[model samples]
Target: MAASRNLPIGFEASVAGGIPILRVIHESTAGDRLRAVHGILNGTANYILTQMESRAIEFDQALQEAQAAGYAEADPSLDIDGFDARDKLCILARMAFGGRLKVSDIPTYGIRQVRAIDIHSAHRLDSTIRLVGSAEQTEAGLEVSVRPWLVGCRSMLAKVEGVNNAVFLLGDKIGMQMFYGRGAGGDATGAAVVSDLIEIARDLAAGQLSAKKVSGFLDSHDVGICPKPRPVSWYLRLTVKDQRGIVARVAEVIAHRDINIDSLEQEPHLPKERLSFVITVEPVSEPIIQRAVGAINAFEFMLEPVLLLRVE
Candidate 1:
């Protein structure tokens, strides 16, 4: 039936049961033109990050707690690896921009490397971290990514804690609109199903039993994905086996890229064998920072890969 109707037929169909579905495809109406859509779509990732921030726990500890709370699966690869959020972002981007999108097309960065020291640095800056999936339409084209973002303490994204989810939509006419609630769990899912059923029942009573096709899905144009670099403040956490000359080596790389370091901090009382260096750089384009990070990661002293986070 979906094939005949030329519907958006993929993930939802596999698990939606027999219920009639209605989705708010942003591009379907002419009343508003979408500018951007950003969301925290994975409950497990959110739960883990929340625990790490509020409880001052490590990534593995938070993951264990999330598993015990039934928020995370035994494997949890999709959630931890950011693929789940990437898939959700693709659907949202397709709806907002009216084009075909694949999960592989979007750049994805997971939260597995986030450490307690990174969380402490964010706390010092009056901010918190969350995995954000975002799609924005620019003059060049659509820019999309799924990664950890440093959200300010006063921002709406930071207020979204625990297993709750939030989606922020920016439109031409509406400006900014936020939708927040429980993004998972049986109770929330059941409520959503019942809401859809009630709306369908009402439409049926009105003698309008037709399915509304998603205009964006129906459109055939391919979404142009342009990788435009935007200037942003960054949080970099590097764990090294030795601290000697490590800062100078990393600083040289950043200077070579013409990026200025706003501040550099190293937490005290850490073992000399395993030290953490937190660096905050002035607003610079992502490509510049990526280049510097690439150079820094190449150093033999690095115990693990450097963690790069976008500062809100």
Candidate 2:
């Protein structure tokens, strides 16, 4: 096709390994642009989270076990640090808007910070952990982020978990549509790559194409990060090697912040030397609850910082 006039495009495989995804492109008519993308590029972290849930092991221990099991790479930073997700998002965003994006420009958070206490607390609130990578039109360019978000059970977004990936497309006329499927494994991702290659080859064979839909991303919009987000309940877990005055100390911090505790429980099975103090606060702004958690975590009796979770 190159011998003749051709403009074949589309990258091979996921920018990262094992994320079953692709970007299909074509000449756009006078209509809103469309794109197809896949996510969840790493199976190591997904498998670790899954096994941890079943084994009821701590995050650190589970990660170590995963490394031993050869599921995780020697340096698993990219997978766990949300960098891989960012790459996938960039591909999706470029296809959606039609421009280039710097991966470093996007903010990302990994599940490494998530704790077993977080899992338990989410369970208490009937929610779960999900890695969400999103790019949405904002007054400023496109607001984008990849991080673990607390999602309610009833929300369709919450249904994506483990190694599965999903994508969402919005258009003036098309509205909203979401695509979901297994997001990891070589075979699945390879198939996606080929799909895009095939389309690009066909388009190249057809003739030169216009840039309207292809270049939408080049139009820069400010990237807005949601601040003062909606109110939601929260969980705070304080870890300490068993000691007296722990409760009183923890209570004082909670009270100072004017945070109302809807429920409080001392985690069962925690040794006296290492106790887990769990508390749930009523619905409030994320910043406020995080402030209280920060204050309480500063207490000397705290073995590790307070683990915070958004409760649905």
Candidate 3:
């Protein structure tokens, strides 16, 4: 891979103890130069989140349904904990931005903490949630992360539901293009493998079998992921052991951070002992929100950690 990047070689060969090997050239600029790549990489996570939004189910229930449908395994730690998507994002970022990256380099957040109330809140805001793996070339460097984001109802990302996958690639020339299809199941994976095999077979038949060296993978430059703190709306949910001045106390923290609250809502018909408070805040940096959340969670009235979601 290193030799291919430095040499004038259109093809390069590799061997594993006399066994023939093949590699796909993924960085083809046959059309437009890519600016960004974003996708729903994990089908199991997507399916679970889809159920939570479409059926108004809780995370555990959606996960169980996904397992029953074979979309998830009995031990779905990688997908549910965001590692699977993190791995995928690493590869995608390398291909898209041509930089060295590791799974641990990117910030990742999973859907394990997502609740029915979060989904319901999303609906009220005319939006839904999806696990998005994205890599974009920005001034700060390659901005990459794998996490759940609140996508507007009319957005293309929100249109992807259930086990289906959609990859959106933005290019300087082509603008924005999306590739959508089934994301999981053996049949889908097998089809992709078979397609590559058939292409290789055709090349061999035509006496054109040769190693096609791909770029980007060999770049050893460290991808400097500077945190680009852009102001954006946020959704925060706090489960509390209901007590007096809960809202006032939380609001004080927000005020201390210099963040403005857009709205505050409480889920009605819930027991006073355990209640959920939903807050929407005006555009604020993630650091500001984190500080406020940290202070709020330190309160004794808190029953669970706060859930935070970015409003797209």
Candidate 4:
């Protein structure tokens, strides 16, 4: 309705707080075709992961501290469970790809399963974990998801610690650009609100309301899902009852699926009743790896479900 009436509508604060990421995609990169838009969209979740990494604490302890520090809500399911990021990703995907995207359609995975042992294992491999939301235009379609990725120490995602956000934009003409700042705080959100108002006032003084012509915001076209996503490395952590031939059995399952094991390690000097096994597999599509994971999980020695993570 507002667009039809040539009314100026501002929503700069709706996405990443105070970063002006929407404006960058809407105005600054208008000439270029956006190939991808991805980043850490949730400050609360980022804070929790960084806290666990720095303090060497469990997810529960980190949640308590985040609540005490006023970084999280009493009902933090939206943030910690990855739905908050999912909603934001849908908006960004629509803008970047110029199509209507349903928030529920995108796949989402949270950091709730992350444990202290996972963090310890990540440190040993010189990597850390971050909840990332990504959307990219592919030959098949738009590939999108919100999940925890095992990022190396030197990567930009790992550098964004605490209650901060970072957004990366890829374009054919502009190449790659990054936007980083405080994602959600009273000050940051307020600043964004004021900036939007200032723009509206300027438009009013000009005697013309700005009509938003963004394709994704106005178009009703549906974005197609990528049928087969490109292959990537993966990390699988399994806790199981100690017994003979466990490794052989797990290897057989992976081999049966035609997936190669990149590296496998068992934590030293653990209890005989329970042990931690970390497996790194070579690049393979999600479906094939999942099949192998299902086979391994069905074994009698498996104590719990496998924790699978994407390796960056």
> Can you give the lDDT of residue 215 in candidate 2?
37
Give lDDT tens digits, candidate 3, residues 146-175.
Answer: 878888999999998877666677878768
C-alpha local distance difference test of each model: 0.76, 0.59, 0.72, 0.79
**lDDT score at residue 118, model 4, on the 0-100 scale:** 85
Per residue, candidate 4 scores C-alpha lDDT tens digits across 161-207 of: 98887888899998998877776643454443223322332343464
**TM-score order of candidates, top first:** 4, 1, 3, 2
Quality of model 4 by C-alpha lDDT: 0.79
Better candidate number, 3 or 4, judged by TM-score: 4
Off by over 4 Å in 3: 1-33, 192-214
Best by lDDT: 4
Ranking by lDDT: 4, 1, 3, 2
Candidate 2, residues 1-312, lDDT tens digits: the string is: 211212223233334332222333222212555423324444556656655555667888987876776556678786677776676676566556555566687767777877776677666666666666666654435656676665666666666555555565665655665656554434454343223422332343354433322333444653344455455777677788877787887777778877788888887876788888778788886678778777877777788776665553
Estimate the TM-score of every prediction: 0.85, 0.67, 0.82, 0.86
Give model 2's TM-score versus the native structure.
0.67
User: Candidate 1 at residue 201, lDDT?
Assistant: 34
Name the runs in model 4 displaced over 4 angstroms. 1-8, 11-17, 185-215
CA shift of 138, model 1, Å: 0.7
